[model samples]
Target: MSKISTAILRGVSGAFIANSGVGKIGMPAEYSAGVQQAAASGIPALAKLPSDKFGTWLGYAETGLGAALLAPFVPSRIAGAGLAAFGGGLLSMYFRNPENTEADGIRPSQEGMSLAKDVFMLAIGLALMTQGDDK
Candidate 1:
């Protein structure tokens, strides 16, 4: 079995990510468009997909990743890889948008605060990936 700390970390992060994904699954058209636009800034290929389709796909991906993290059967390495990828993508998006950062280009602007908070997800993923068999 995993350690209590690991379990709690995975449970909380997984639930939050899963809930966010569920909320995005049926997002409004405008919301979907906005999300797509932001994502496309980091990954230009994403622009090829329709806004609604991108939103739905993103939701599914997040849900699957969250489920993986929450499942004890899934190794920390695997789950962490998924979380790292997801978190990295979000960070990329945030960095790519000038409006998201301040004049220094590193600090989060008012518009970027939400995305900036995702850094903790990335850190947690890295920590999980580096954990020993105790996980």
Candidate 2:
């Protein structure tokens, strides 16, 4: 990957991650609902956390990850790995709740649509990691 390609990938993924975090802050109702629904996702006591506190902290973490991925000195591969891990967790959450997906499971239901968008993050993450050697 050329520097320009790497930069573009990081910029887009970082912005999306940061935007999602910001949305959690601005849309408390939707954010809280999503958090509550994670109770069956095998995430330990995530749902037990107070909604506001959970949302705030999650927002910070996502925002920080986005920022780190965008930092010039940060290794692209490392950033990509971090983003990929986060995407995996999100994807896991989706699978843990089958009702959120279509009958076929792979296709997302109405509610799972938002979660499905994380595929882009996963792809971008892998792209950054794989292309690191070329930069």
Candidate 3:
């Protein structure tokens, strides 16, 4: 990949993860509600865990993943893989709950849309993985 493209991907994905990590830590009402929704939707275990603990774990994981993607010392593919797993988990939650989507049952509900964007992280992770090949 060209340097410009790589930089853009790194910057955008890094920022996104970083923001999510921070928000998870803060546990703002909206973010907390989203977490609860995830638990209620499919990840029932999350609902059982204390929200503070769950949010803290999520926050740290996201922060580490974001840092890895942003830092030159870390391999992008590895970081991307971690990010992909996280994003996949979120997608799974969305998939498990049709009610989270619109009437079409394809697009996410307004609240779910924020998480719907995590789909891009999966793509980004795949792209980074493919970077092992020469452009």
Candidate 4:
């Protein structure tokens, strides 16, 4: 790959990692809800030991993994794979929730756009995973 391409890849990877880290931490409610749901649906006895504890751990894991991906020394491909997997899980959850309609306070058009963005970002992450750090 060209020097410029590598630079662009690195910049994109860094930005994505950092931004995702912040989102994961800032949006603890989202992850917490997932954990709670998983626990309620017979996820695992250990995981459901304490709902609040599980939620906190899930939040920490999300933020920590995201930050690790942002570190300069980390391999871009691994980071991308992690983020891609996370995005896929999120996408699946969002789609699975039948109650997530505009009637639930989420504007249908905006939700569609957000879903598109998530899918696009997931594609970018998968592309990065397949392509490695450089073009």
Best by lDDT: 1
Ranked by TM-score, top first: 1, 2, 3, 4
TM-score of each: 0.92, 0.81, 0.78, 0.58
Off by over 4 Å in 3: 26-48, 102-104, 109-111, 133-135
Model 1 ranges off by over 4 Å: none
lDDT of 1 by residue, 1-135 (tens): 359878987889999899888878877778888889989998889889988677877888888888988999998878887888889989998899999999999999999999899898898888788888752
lDDT against true structure, model 1: 0.87
Across 10-52, the per-residue lDDT of candidate 3 in tens digits comes to: 7789887888787777666556666666755666666776655
Model 4 lDDT tens row, 1-135? 453654465466556655555554434565666666743433334344554455665556666655655565666677667768766765664555544435553443454445535665477567667773442
| CA shift of 7, model 1, Å | 0.8
- Clashing residue pairs for model 3: none
The best candidate by TM-score is 1
At residue 4, what lDDT does model 3 achieve? Answer: 70
- Residue pairs in steric clash, candidate 4? none
Off by over 4 Å in 4: 1-35, 38-49, 100-116, 132-135
Global lDDT of model 4 = 0.57
Q: Tens-digit lDDT track for model 2 on 12-117? A: 8898788877766644766665775673383656767776567667778788888878787888888998899888778877777787699988899999898888
